[model samples]
Target: MSALQVGLAVAGGLLLGGVIAWETWNARRRAPRQPVPERRPPAPEEGERVEPGVASALPTADDERLEPGFDTAPGALSPLGPVPAPEKRPRLDALIDVIAPIALDGRVVSGDAALAALPATRRVGSKPFAVEGRNVLTEEWEFPIAGQRYDALQAGVQLANRTGPLNEIEYSEYVMKAQHFADALGGAPEFPDMLHEVARARELDEFAATHDAQLSFTLRARLTAWSPGFVHQQAARLGFTAGAIPGRMVLPAEEPGLPPVLGLVFDPRAALSEDPEQSAINSLALSLDVPQVHRNARPFGRLRDVAFALAEVMDGEITDDTGQPLRTEMIDKIGQDLAQLYDTLDAHDLAAGSPQARRLFS
Candidate 1:
């Protein structure tokens, strides 16, 4: 071996070693983190058969925080999880605080009297109104006005319209109603120009549009495979009640007054089919009407679990709204987007799923 040959061999060995080290570092950096495994209930013993329609036992309070994983076998519907408490309502911004106030005169007029003077109907066009005391912003009502006797008192009425500005007809109707109420009370009425509030309403509406998002996942069974009855049975076991429309199942909102957050439709139009057998369900859909539902609420996690479980049981694949296959990575990405959206709404004092927001968004 010559000196030059020995030197060249050493240099090549060092270069190869450095290249291998760089590749290893890059691979580790690019690798995804493993998700925490969801806790699941133990399987039934051999020869044991669970009947459909029997409700699963509820989890204890301490176990409420844990989420369940999706299972594929028959009778594996996961129990519903607890809903997290909503974030505190934030103070309303000046823009959102804008109101079209109607003030009436007469100490004789009580809240009931003023309310009676207005149209008997609760809503003017699509905008709902509330009668309040001199202060229209507060929830307090002027009914049973008690105080020192005065020549006249002011009764205020305002609209509950949100997420959109009032149109010309709505504005006209509101002003007319206020004037009519004043006349009935035998006192004059005053109102702010509709255009000013309309402008402000538009700004709030724009903010809502920017933050609003709808999340949906579709499940398609292997072609010509599952029956509609099977889909319905599985969905019922998962806690979805049948909706008004056939083939539609809804998970009722956790908070009674709120709207349902998630819906499952199995071939929505199957009932209209001439041949019942031909209408066998080929695909199922799961969707969340995001703005209508609160984030981190039980429905959010439960819906995801139900979709995954159904996909497993039916030998189906889950896809995005556009029909592209949905992967676990995609689910995480969607979740991150939702968290950011919730933060934005909270910052603006319009937390999604709050009472005020529900009225506005509705």
Candidate 2:
């Protein structure tokens, strides 16, 4: 071959190799990253302890080194003043329950007699069933207590839940349970028209399906992966504590009985691992169930703040399920939309975070 031709061939070979190398580099960069095993951290250092708290807001967002204040007496949270006893869940509401009134014919029924007449289980098919008695003196409807006297009785079954709308089978089951209980107490029971009530369930389910909203953001490690202990320690500084489930943390509501305001979750496997520090967790999740939390608690805002705060301290990036970066504009827009949702729920008599709304949404 001519000398000029040989030189051109050599130049072309080098250029082709360079192009392949560049493409490979870009591919690796774009691919999702895996977790890197982490080592155990040192003991606590000189710092302010993060006080354990959960409510409308944390004491302060910037504080680090938060710790749970334990009561020497009963292991209760002390800083919050003995962690008030969890409040009783609210009673059934007619708006969400298919109620059946039982006429006792002026017979004074003992609480024990009523309790004995209750169904073997409180559930009628997929819905929750409750029986309330009208106290003779107080004139209030409540569950039968062992020693109380009641003049009237009523039973109710939930209309809808996460499982779906009430159907023929469930409504029938409710009727049977109510009838059996009323017969034992010698009370005449009256239930709504089944078909009509079932229709109401469908409509309510439709509204719920359209309005139900839950938000989640995944935080992927930007450099080094996190260990379970590391994740817990960092979140504790922000007033989060170990939640009921493994690998989950919760920001508690100020109201003892209310559902948590927000959740922080990581890989369960890592949390359960024998050597948690050696188990790498590449991603974490933050979530909010809008209807479960009260609007005054500002759940969405708290979730946003916690997400960004954790990302900054942990050297991570907040992304969607697909790992795409979640932009600030999108997050802000969600907050605005949530505000509108809260208003709609309020208009429907199921305000966000209210007991009635919580039960219906459940």
lDDT of the candidates, in the order given: 0.59, 0.81
Residue 103 lDDT in candidate 1: 35
Tens digit per residue, CA lDDT, model 2, 25-79: 9766544333334444465567957567543322242345221221111122323
lDDT of 1 by residue, 87-194 (tens): 343222233443333433434445555555656764556766433344233433343233412234333222334435556677677667656656776776556666
Angstrom error of the Cα, residue 186, model 2: value is 0.8
C-alpha displacement of 304 in model 2, angstroms? 0.5
Candidate that would win on lDDT: 2
Clashing pairs in 1: none
Q: Candidate 2, which ten residues in sequence have the lowest lDDT sum? A: 67-76
| Winner by TM-score | 2
Could you tell me the lDDT of residue 34 within candidate 2? Answer: 34
